[model samples]
Structures are given as C-alpha cells and as structure tokens.
Target chain A: MNGFAIVWQERALFLEGLWNTVSLVVAAIAISVPLSALGAVVLVEAPRPVARLARALIDLTRCVPFLLLAYVIYYGLPQLGLRFDAWWAGLVTMTLYNAAYLAEIFRSAWLALPKEGFEAARAYGFRPATLYRRIVLPQIAYASAPLVGGQIIVMIKDSALLMIITVREISFAANSINANYFTPFAPFVVAIGMYWMLSLIVEAWVRRVASGARLRYG
Target chain B: MTWAAFETLLTGAGTTVALSLAGLAIGVPLGLALALIRWARIPVADQLVATYVSLVRATPLLTFVLFVFFVLPTMGLELDPVPAAIVTLALNTAPFNCEIWRAGLTNFPRDQLEAAEACGMTRTLAFRRIVAPQLWRVCLGPLVSEMTILLKATPAVAVIGVVEITRAASRIGAATYDPLPPFLAATVIYTLLIAVIVQAQRVIEALIARRYGYAAP
Candidate 1:
C-alpha cells in the first residue's frame, strides 16, 4: 500500500476503536447511574451496620485495580459454574466498579442536603418516600451532577481495563493493530486521542446540562 | 488452593506493600517539590509545570507503564520491570499529590503569613514556622486520601512483570491452567489490605487531629 493508503487505513482503524470505546462507556454509564442511586439510598437510609458495610464494600471495590477485577470476573466466575456470555464479564465488572464510585458521589450529595428541608417535609405530613421522590432526589441530583459526571469520565477511562479481560474494546483493538503493524506509536497515540476527545465531549455535555438545570431552577 | 501456594501469595503481598511504600517514599517528596515549583509563580516555569501536570493527568496509567517499559529501551536506558513500574507509578502519583499539596498551600490562611511577615520574620522562616504547620492541618485529609490511593494503585505495577500479588496470581494461574483460585486469593488479599489501609488512615488522621486539638469528623 502507498503511504496515503496506509494512513487512511490507520485512521479507519482508529475511528472504529474510538466508536467501540464510546459504546462501552455509554453501556457502562447508562446502567451505572440508577444502580448507584439505589445503592447510595440504601447505604444512607439503612441502619448503621448496613451503612458501615456499604461503605466498606465501596472502599474494597475501589481499591482493586480494574484490570485485576476484570481478570477475576472473567476467569474466576466460570470455575464457580457461572459463565457469562461474551462481553458480560467486562460490562458487569465495569458496572460494579462505577457503581461503587457513583454511590459515594450520591451518598455525599444525600448527606449534604439541607436538614431543614427534610424537617419541613416531615412536618407537613409527607411520608419518607414522598419526601425523597418529590423534594430530595431532585436537589441531590442537582448538587451531584458535576461530581457524578466526573465519576463517569473516570469510569470511561477505566473501561480500557476491560481489554485485559478479552473484551475487543478500544484499547484491545488498538493493541491488536499495533501488534500487526509492529509499531506502538500510531495505534496507541490514536487510542489516546480517542480517549481525550471522548472525555472532552463528556465534560462539555456535563457543563451544558449543569447550566440548563441552573437556568430552569435558579 | 493449597496452603503452600497460599503462603506464596502472602509473600507476594509483602512485595506489593514494599513497592507501594517505595513509590510513596519517592513520590511524596518529588510531588511536594513539583507542587512548590508549579505554584510558586516562578519565571517561565509555571506554564511548563502546568503542561506537565496536564499531560500526566490526562494519560492513562497503562499508557504510562507501557511507554516506560517498552519505549524507553530504544533510548539507551535499560530498566528492569520493578524499577520501571516504580518510575511510572511514582510519576503517575506525583501529579495527583502535587495538585493536592498545591491546593492545600494555596488555601492556607493568608492573614497568618502576613502576621508572620509583620513580626519581622524572614520569608523562609515565616513559611517554616507559620505556614508549613498550618498547611499540614488543612492538607491532612487529602494527604491521607492520596496515600490510600497510592496503596490502592500498587496493583497496577503488576502489569510490568513485578512479582507483586497480582503478578504472583497471574503466575499461579498460568501454571495451574486455572485462574480462579489464585485470582480469588489475590482479590481477598487486596480487599483485606485496602480495608486495613482505610482503617489505618482513619486512625492516623484522628490521632493527628486530636494531637493538634482539631476535631475530626
């Protein structure tokens, strides 16, 4: 192939990897948000032992490297007679990791809510469920949007770890390309560019949503 | 699965802890220096510092490890996996620690420094006697959290062939033709170590706060 042809081929390969990265991130984040919200509510509303256990679990989950977690779930589950379909290992592991972080973000936002607001709702004869659904959840989402957005960005970066678990994600695809080409610079650099672009998009979207919420509620 | 192999994994835990401590030893001082230089508003250096920090923060840790291990060989420096892992880990952690310390230093009370200057103390002496101690108090939480991060991040070093717990687990997996037992053992060890570190951080932070008469929540 001529130089221009080779360059075009590399670009195509890179774009495909970029698309994969985006899809994986979307899949991970799409499911993670609600799971985290529910997990956060449980941690906060449950008794002291439950809260302590939840916090410990979050810390434990966050401590292990994503690659190691991916390895465990990918390879360890089958031995326990629980074999996931292709892509499930990566998705499940990433979701679990992101959920832990998202839970912490939501928990902090929950704790930061004005006690007076809750008190007023309670005094007005609102049930706990009604108080949470009507008054508290909205405020917590507003307060936690940027932080939760940041966590999602971190989660996207972490999805690269799924490559180790045999997921044909962006980094894994890039690595295969590099192996065939015998040059690390092109494929790896392209992957980095993809990550940078995706993260920039995430940050911009987060800012826009934050401003929209402010305009609506301010 | 055997007790004997479990003992080997336990030995590997020591390697992980040692690598983490080594990274901390190098990273903390280097990070503090970079933080000071970056925030000190020096001539022509501030922009460079900011750029360096941005590059490090934006790149994935895996990329950093791959570059250091694979690319550095062509540059005439032949570093072993452990050293390479340490270099990357320390470099990765430094930018974070630098930012944390810089935030602490910048947010420290301005009036106290002014008061020290008004008392006719030299600038270095003022920072030493007045600002540094106060900065420590403000930075305590972030510092503890960053250390916890360092401990947590040690597992990444395994990627470079360091015989840390994760690396050891990989070895067992490869040998046994089974990944579960070793990986599960590593996971348990990792979870336990992290719990211990978190608890230790809380205790140390509480002790420091109490000694300084500052209430810890």
Candidate 2:
C-alpha cells in the first residue's frame, strides 16, 4: 500500500517515462520498417555476392543481443570518430537490431510468393521500381503484418534497455523513483503495466489491419 | 583487447552458457507440465495457467529480471545474483515453452490416443509411447528458437552483477576507456555461441524427423 502510494504521488514521472518510451518505439518503427524492407529486397533481388553480404550482416545483427549492441554503439563508436548522443544511439541500435529480424521475416514472405506474379510484372514492361512498389511490397506487407506486429512489441520492450544509457525511458524513470522513494515494486510494476497495455493495443491494431488486408488482397 | 581481457570474456561467456542451459533445463519440463495442466482443463488450475502464460508473455524479460532481482528480497525471499538470474530466466522462458507445448498438445491427433486405448494400453503408456515422441518432433524447432532467445537474454542478468559476456565487455570498456575491442570480441563470442545452438538444433531436428517420420513441421 505504501509503495503504491509513493508511485501514485509521483505519477508525473511515470507518465513522462511512458511518453518517452512511446516516442522511441514510434520513431524506431518508422525508421526500421523501411530499412528492413530495403534490406529484404536487396537480399532477394541483388547479385550473389551482394546478397551474401547482406545475409551475413542480417545474421550478425540477429544473433547479437540488443543490449550489447547498444553498449557497443554507445561506448565504442566514438573511438571510430562517430559520435551520437545516447538518445540517438539508442534509436539507431533499436533500428539496427530489429531491422535485421523484420528483414528476415519480410525476405521469407517475399520468397514464398508465387513466381507468376513477379514474372507477370516483369513481362508487362513495368519499371523495376514500379514492380517493387506495386507488386512486391504490398504482398509482403500483408503476409507479414502479424509478424511485424510481434516485432513492434519487441521493439517496445527493448526500448526499456535505453535507460541503461541514461535515456530516461520508462524503466529509468521507475528506477529513479525507486532510488528516491525506495519503492521498487510499485514503480516497476506500473511501468510494466504501461508496456503491457501498449503491446495489447499494437496487437489489436495489427489484427484489424490483417483482417482488412485479407478482405482486400487475399 | 589484451589476452587477459579475452580470457575474462571467455570466462564470462562460460557463465552465460551455464546459466542459460540451467534455465532451459528447468523451463522445458516446467512448460510441459503447465501445458498439460491446461490441456486437461482441470477447472481452476487451467484458468490459472492460462493467465500466467498471458501475463508472462506480455512483459519484457528485462522488466521481469529487474523485478526478481530487486523486489523479491522485500517478500522475504532473498537470493544471490546468480540464483536470482537463473530464477528470472527460467520464469521468463517457461511461459513461451508452455505455448509451444500447448500447440503440440492441442493439435495432436486424437485418434492415435483412442487407438492406443482400444489396444488396452494404460493412459500413462499411451502418452509415453505415442504422444511424447510426436510432441518432441513438433515442438523442437520453436523450442530451440526459444533457447536462443533465452541465451541472448543472459545479459539482462548483468544488472545484478553476474558478469556474463556483455557485462564483462562493459567492465573492460570501463577499465581501458576504449570499448571497441572488448565489445567486438563479445559480439563474436555471442555470434559463435548462438550459431552452435542453431547448428545443434539442425542436427537434433534431423534426428527427430528421421525417427518419427516428420512430414509437414
């Protein structure tokens, strides 16, 4: 009761943290999904050596832990004459880590598409960019909506790790409240509830879009 | 990184592997048991299990890790860093495995069990002889993926001072003020480690498929 009371008293801090977390995820998804689509297209359409290089990089990003990658980007980059503020570094790392995962997803769905559609687009004399824009992207996006939703939730969760680099995201704000009020349980549980709510909303939205895609495209 | 730093990272990687394996060992069976409880539809127990899975699936591993490490002590269940980490990993992964196992259980062909019962096989024997192998064959791929995710999550334990590979990298960076070498080394180690897991999964999946005549999955 006392711990929760403290959390309620500092509701402003939690709300602020929640907002930062939302902004990070929205920004990360905006950047990562386009980048992922580009990477996926490259993997499927590029020449052998270039495709292989893309595959290797995607696999590397997939295997590396997000937190470790963030640490590297935050601490190691300056040595290479690259300097990003911790906030931008967090966003960039989120983009890098989840882009690989989403790219893998999109790439597989792209491969699974029927060969006739692609060949038909080619024979119609459609430009390469037009073929991709009209045929390739829409089909993959529909097929991959559910998985992309899952990854979006993952990105939301991973945003909490940015607190380690002093980004003052939800978990950081909760932790600071703990540091001040010595109420660990209340603040973290509150922060996590917000995350859970965000995930549910994303999932519901994905379901809506997927059903619509099915009606329109399937 | 110097040779000493390399040695330190190796040691940290070892700890990471050990913790993840221990967590997997506990989580797999625990998940199976939970799935069974839900499958049986035993009144309140089934509903409890469902809620537990949903709740766990909704939260992040780091939030769960922080909760166990920081909040558990106030409830009069204090634990050291390593044990707390193992607990956190096991708790976090079990719900995922539960879902995987439940999928196999629900989708299992009911006629096989009926035929076994008509053959006068006991319920235990029917499950042991028929259901278990097929479940393994069905669940192996997703189970392995979960294991890899758990391994990737080991770094979250570092917050409470477990000094796994990522933690060691951070420490080395702090000591030398040049994080590139150690972090790069850590990345290589983690990549190689996960590759081993994936490769082993391939070997195991091939074996299971051959033994069970796996078809679609």
Candidate 3:
C-alpha cells in the first residue's frame, strides 16, 4: 500500500499512540514540577550539609542517561522484587530525570530573588508559609516560567525513548509498522511530524505563559 | 562481576567514548558552517538551516538514529551499525552545536569584524583572528555540556545493535541475573566520563582566560 493508505489504515493505532504520548507527558509534568520546586526549596533553605547532599544527588541523577535509567527502573527493579509496569517505569524515569533539571532551574531562580523581599515580607508579619505562598513562590514561578517550559518540551521529546521498553508510544507504533509492512519512511516520517507538531504546540503555549508571567510579575 | 565482564564493559565504554568523540569532531565543523551560513544571511540557505536545526532539535534522537539505520538501506546506501550510529549522531549533534555557535556569534560584537577588515584582513582571517577566540570562550561551556549529552546518547545506538556500554550492562545483567551490579557499574562509568569532561572544560576555559588576561567564568 501507498504511504497515505498505510497511515489511513493505521490511523487508530497512531491516534492511540499519540494519546499515550500526550498523557505520559502530562503525567510526568504534573508530578515532577512540584517535586522539583520542593527540591529546589530544600536545596536553598536546608542546612549546609543537607543541601550539599541534595545537590550531589541531583548531579548524580543528571549524569546518568535516561535510557539506562529507564532500563534500570524497568528491568532492574523486577530483579529487586520491586516491579512496576512499563508505563510506570517510563513515567518515573521522566519525572526523576526532568526533576533534576527543573530543580536546577528553580534553584537559580530562588537564588536570584532579592534578599530584601524576604525580609520585607517577614517584617509585614507574614508567617513562613504565608511568605512563601504569597510572595516567594509566585515570584519563583514567574521568573522560572520560561526555563520550566523548556524542560517540559524536553520531557516531551524524552518520552519517545520509552518506546524501547515497550511502552507502545508513537515511536513504538512506528517501529511496529516498519516491521510489519517494511515501510520505514511513512511511519517514522509521520511520527517525526507528530513530535514536531507537539513541540510547536508546547512552544506556543510556553510563549503565551511566559509573556503572561512577564506582564503579571513585571 | 568477574574480571571478564568488567573487561567487556570497559571495552564497550571505550566504544561509547570513541563514538561520541567522532561524532563531535565532524559535527562541530558542520555546525560552525551552518552557523556561518545563517550569520551571513544567505537567502535560501538560512531558511534551510533554520528548518534543519528546528527539526533536529524537536525530534528525539532515537527517531533520527532509527531513520538513519533503516531508511538509508532502502536507498541502496547500506551502513554497518557503527558507521550508522556515528553518522546519525553527527547529524543529530550538528544542529545543536550550530545553535550554540549562533548564540556565540550573536553575542560577539559586530564592530570587531569591521575593525579586522579595516586592518586589511580578509573575512576568513578576520573571523579567525578577531571573532573565533571570543566565540570559543562563549561556546566552550555549552559545547562541553553538549558533548556530555552526546556521550549519554551513545547508548541509543545500542538499539541498532552496536553493543555500547548500556547494552553491555543489560547483557551482563541478563547473564548474571543480577541486574543491579552491571547497571550500577555503567552508571559510575558514565558519571566519571562526564566528570572528566567537566574538569577538562574547566582547564580549557582557564587556559583561554589566562591567555586573554581575564578571569574564567
């Protein structure tokens, strides 16, 4: 069959894969961003040794390749009698990997905050939680909106690697099509197009958020 | 793990290192050319370069590796796994390095080139003398980070059956039925490799800074 016919015939499979990819990205971001923000706060506010240890752990996580990390979590965990489904493994790996990067981004944003802002909020009788919730956290979110968005884009791209562990994402679907039909070009080209389109949507969305944050905060 | 398994893993790590270096060696020059083409505002070439960079950046490296490994054979251009991995990686990396170089070029002052030209230097010589050194300074940190990324990506080549470090780790784990050891070993190797690159980056940046009579960033 021709490329168009092949794509049309497998439209449902492609759609399923697309849905899986989008959902995986959403799940990963939903979980990881908050963890990263918390880790960033700990890195900045924790005592010296605790912060140092946290920084080292973050560095170690960042150094290891995501694919290897996925393999370890998916296959290695089973051997340790702590098994997870392939999707869970993929989601956990993405969360852990991207959290390290996001933590770094957030930490920098936190450090860049003016010291006087914190003192002023304290002087205005704001409790610690209230100070963070009302003043500090909002500014960090606003300042790091662009970088956090970039990391999310990276998270989207990285989700494709989950296919190797049989998560049946778009790349996996493409591989199956290639193996079944001996048609390498159509499936992969379509997969790449899908990924590119996803990235564009993310980029546009991020730009809008960043501009909004700039206007609101500045 | 036994000495033999450790030896095998080391051999695989060597392949990983070599593949990353080879990819970067070719990709960096290609990236520089792409950056210069865009910098010159060459009408069609600039747009083509933009498309290439964006496409490469947006898609996963795994897809690009798969495409190079599979599609080239259909066009009567067969490549073995190693060559395919290297070619795919260089293709993947060039676009990123191009963007890095472009950023460096953008930050560089335009008047320096004019000054060099006024001093009777040709365009190429002007770039070499006036622009290249500062560009190298600005680009070195990002490029080193990119190299670490390329090194991390070498494992993706294992999909096409190149048997790099990560694949070797998996194989050994399967053989020994102890997945943790082999994978942990691979992690250590990768971390050490990246640490070396980071140290070397510091050294090179310091040397450049000393020569230019400025403190390193």
Candidate 4:
C-alpha cells in the first residue's frame, strides 16, 4: 500500500484520539466549573483565613506550568499508594490548573457588580441562597463568560500535554503514527491544523455568547 | 535525591536567569520598534507586524521552541539550543509586548500633544517631553506582567536541551532514578524565583509611578 493508504487505514485510531480529546475536555470542564464557581464565591464571602488560603493556593497553581503539574499528579501520586490512569491524571490536572484561573475570573466578575444590587436583592426578602441563584449567577455568567471561553480554548490546547503521561490524545496518537511511519512532519502538521480548527470554533462560540449576554443583560 | 545532586540543580538556576535577562534586553527594543512601526503608519511594516503578532500569539510556545531547536539547523543556519531557545522565546513574547506598549502609547491624552504643538515644540521634542514619559508610566504594569510570563516561559528552553533548572532536574532524575525530589526541588525554586520577580516588579512599578507622578486608579 502507498503511504497515503497506510495513513487512511489508521483513520479509526486517529479518530479515537480525537474522541478522547473531546471527552477529556468535556469531563474536566464539566467537573471544574461548578467547583470553581463555589470556590470563587467562598473566596469572596469566606472568613479571612479561608480566603487567604484560597488565594495563596490559586496563585501557586496559576504560576506553575500545566505539564509540571501533570507530571506531579501523574508521577507523584503513586508515592501516596494511589494510582490514577493516564486519563484520570490528565482530567485531574487540567481541572485543577484551569480552576485556579477560572476562579480568578469569577471573583473579578463578582467584585465588579454594583454594591446596590446586593442591597436590592436583600431588600426584596430573598434568601441569600435564592438571591445568589436568581440574581448573582446570571450577572456573573454574563460578565465572566468571555474569560471562561478563553480558558476553555486554553484547556483544549493543554490537552496535548497529556501526551507526556501516555494518554492517547491527538498529539500522542500523532507522535505514535510518526514513529511508525517515520514521517514527523505530517502528524505534527495535522495536530497543528486540528488545534487551529478547534480554537477557531471556540472563538466563534465565545463571540456568539458574548453578544447574546450583552443583549440580554444590557 | 542526594544533597550533591540537588546542589547541581541549584547551580543551573543562574543560567536560567541569564537567558531570561538576555531575552528581555533584546526583546524590549525589538518589541518597541515593532509597535512603533505599527503605530506610526509605516506602510508595509504595519501590516506585516500585525500579522506577525497574530501568528505568534496563536501558535503554542512549545511548537516554536521545537522548531527553533530542531528545524532551523536543517535549513543551514545553526544555533546552539541555548541561543535558539532564547530567540524563539523572545520572538514569541515580542508580539504581546508590542501590542501592549502600543496600547499604552494610545492612552496618552491628545490635548497634551496639541499643547506641545501649540508651544512650538517639534514632534520629537513633543514625544520626548510629553508622550514618552506618560507611555512608560502607563506601560509599566503590563510590562511587569509580561516579564513574569517570560520568566515562567524559561522552562520551555529545557525542552531544547538547555541545562536550565528544569533540564537539570530531569538529568538528576534520570541518573538517580528519583524523579520526585529533584522535580519538587525544581518546583520550589521556580515558585521562589517567580515570587521574587513579581515582588521586584511591583516595587519597581510603584517607584516609577511615584517618580513620574502617575496616579493609580
């Protein structure tokens, strides 16, 4: 078979890698967003000690590279006598790292609100929980959606780093294909092209959401 | 894992600092020049610089580092990994710096320029006396933040075989077969280094703001 035919024959394997990438992103973000939102809310409302600790941890996480963090999670966890599969390792690391960033975005959005908005919510006989659920979340979502969209784009790019820990993501699959075919160029080029297409889709979605939020909230 | 191995990793920190500083030295001026070419209505240079910014910003740092370290030599221009990585990192960062600096320049008040012109000041003198000072003051915060990113990005050089702290840790890990201690030690070093850079940038920013009479909101 020709080289192109050989590549075509591996289509299922490559598509599986793409599927893994999508599922990992969806799972990680699905888990992280609510946790991050709660962290952000608590960070803003909690007592001084908890707030200080949360801020410090977030700062440290943001400053470290994701690959290094993944390495720690992937390799360091075994010392505690608990092992994670490569998929779980990637999910955990991505969620933790991106949570730190998203929490900051969330906190900033909350802080930007008019102080009178909170007063008005309290004056309306709404419980704190009901107030936040009804009034605050919608506003924060409108304000923070653009930044959160950027974070999602970043997360997609970062899924490639999972290759270091042997997860069969797009980049990892490409590397393996290159090893078999001895053509590094095609695989890497494909990986880049795939990443670019993903980012463009993300950017378009962000724009649509941002415009919708402006129309609804403004 | 031993104290001796840890000491070797600590020694490599100096090289990381030097490479970062060298990149800053070249990148600042190059970035400023690009910003001016874009802002000053230079015909061909403006479009080219804008495209350069978008392309560089869109691509991953890892790809650029890999290309510099691996691909350039095959095209006949050879550089050691240290220089190659430095070049790539600086080029990767320059676009953002250029755009940020230009934004700072645009933030200057138009009335000041008109006032300088009213005083019969030449354009160069007007920029020197009125615009440049305010630009630097306004630009310092963004510059400090960008510098923090550049410091963080020095680890990327380790990918290209530079024996920076990250590479040193990996080497020690391979030889001793204890990846945790060295990697953890490197992590602590990185954290400490970032803290120091960030605090130093803050101090300098405050001092410059005070000296220049720039008000913070």
DockQ score, prediction 3: 0.74
CA lDDT, candidate 4, residue B81: 86
On the 0 to 100 scale, the lDDT of residue A72 in model 4 is 76
Q: What is the Cα-based lDDT of residue B154 in candidate 2?
A: 86
Give the DockQ ranking, best first.
2, 3, 1, 4
- DockQ winner among the candidates? 2
Residue range B53-89, candidate 2, lDDT tens digits: 8677778777778888889988989999999999989
lDDT of each: 0.76, 0.88, 0.89, 0.78
lDDT of 1 by residue, A1-218 (tens): 33233435767665665666677778888898898898898898889998888888887788776777777777767777888854788788888988998999999989987899889999999998999899999888888889877777667767766665566666776667656765555566666666766767777888987998889677
Tens-place lDDT digits, model 2, residues A51-156: 9999999999888998999998898888899989978998899989999999999999998889899899999998989998999888888889998998898888
| Chain A, model 2: TM | 0.93
Better of 2 and 4 by DockQ: 2
Most lDDT-accurate candidate: 3
Candidate order, lDDT descending: 3, 2, 4, 1
lDDT of 1 at A184: 54
lDDT score, candidate 3, position B30: 96
Worst 10 residues of 3 chain B by lDDT: B208-217
Better candidate number, 1 or 2, judged by lDDT = 2
Per-residue lDDT of A61-131 in model 4, one digit per residue for the tens?
A: 87776777877787767766768999999999989998998999999999998889889989989998999
Cα misplacement distance, residue A29 of candidate 4 (Å): 2.1
Compose the digit string of candidate 3's lDDT tens values, residues B32-109.
999999988999999999999988888888888888888899889999999999998999999999999999888777
Candidate 1 residue spans exceeding 4 A from truth = A1-8, A47-56, A122-130, A209-218, B215-217
